[model samples]
Target: ARKGVAKSEQYEIRREEEEMRSQMSCHSLKKRAVLTTDSGNCTAEEASESEAENSSMDEGDDEEGSHEESEVEVLDEKGFRRTQEKKISNVKQTELKAVEDEEDDDVENLLKEEEEFEEKIDFSADTAGALKWKEDLTQKAAQVFLRQQQSTPNLRKLIYGTVVEDEDRE
Candidate 1:
């Protein structure tokens, strides 16, 4: 009795495995059929079926077309022209908006550059202020040299021995 029960269990497992294998083979066959259809390898019957589906869909579109025709009749020529003009104006407005945005960006960039330049100038001014005495030293020396030359009054005479000037004085 124990051996018979074990055999029954094994038989049941084998049956389940066979069922799973059949399901997998069916799934793979369906996938291959889809692949072949998508690759444009469908039969004439499949193509005709797809055409029939498309024709049924187009019949629905025909009802929508009648609604559009009714709406067109409701819109007079003047109203249609006004709508066209509104569309043109909207396009122009969008173009102008884009230009204004670009100009705003350019102005922002310029402002940023100006601020950077001002910062650099401020920094340079601070360093230049610290070195101000060096520039003043040369000017101060030049002034002192000029003052000594003016007070002495005879630099050319000392250097050249004052030939014509001393004779004139004598």
Candidate 2:
């Protein structure tokens, strides 16, 4: 019985660690969305569109790997969003400052690129794919949650480790 208990404790600890890692990665994606998306409200519509796009591409993938094209587009959108966010941050800081003529031209060029990128974004297929991706992520997150709940001892230890002994005792 003692050996069984010890083994279970070790398993709990490992599960807790996995859950922690999953939560961190999940929140990192949320943080990226918060930083890149203008408002948190659009996330729902964005997800819906992504799922619709995924549905459309599902049939196409059976053919000559045409669905990979949508996959590439999805990846490109993510990259573009990240890059645009960085450029926007830089532009925001300099908007109120006097800039060199060269800097002004560069900013204009960046703005034009941003506009073109936005115009190229297709909501139909991308939305469906995004929704599918989100559902998969959420499902994984739910599994992590269940694992955390089942390994409550490790969770309690983790929480208590951060608290003062006096507070924890109470």
Candidate 3:
């Protein structure tokens, strides 16, 4: 009795495993069939999708056409000569907008660079201030040099320009 019960349980488990394997294989085959099937030329869904894509593509062209038509109507009311003037100003507006954006970018960059340079200058000045003796000595040396150059005519001439003889001076 015990052996028979064990055998039945093993058989039930094997059957269930086989059923699951077959169900998976069937599902995979159905998926393969759907992918491989070709119903013929374009279906209604495909045609609709293609039409939607084309309509979207044409939308930009339609916008351009409408703008041109409006311009033509306006020009008809204004006159032909005015059309040329309007076009010239229209073109200038686009060009000027681009130029203004470029100038804004350039100005922004210039201001950033100026801020960075000021930071470096401030840092160097702070460091120089921290060294009181060194800063004073440098200043004194520059002043002494300037005075010596000013007091000596020969030295001043050599430092500045050619020494004028009396005729050249006149």
lDDT of 3 at 90: 39
Candidate 1 vs candidate 3: the TM-score winner is 1
- Position 128, candidate 1: lDDT: 44
Per residue, candidate 1 scores C-alpha lDDT tens digits across 16-95 of 97797566555555554444333331221122122223333334443343334323423454464453344334323333
Candidate 3 lDDT by residue in tens digits, 60-159: 4433432353336333654644643453343333334444555545544443454334434433433343233333443454455556546767754565
Q: After best superposition, candidate 2 residue 150: deviation in angstroms?
A: 29
Q: Residues 57-126, candidate 2, lDDT per residue (tens digit)? A: 3333322232343355456766765644553443434442434445656665665565445535544435
Which ranges in model 3 have alpha carbons more than 4 Å from their true place?
A: 38-170
Best by lDDT: 2
Clashing pairs in 3: none
Order of quality (lDDT): 2, 1, 3
TM-score of each: 0.25, 0.25, 0.24
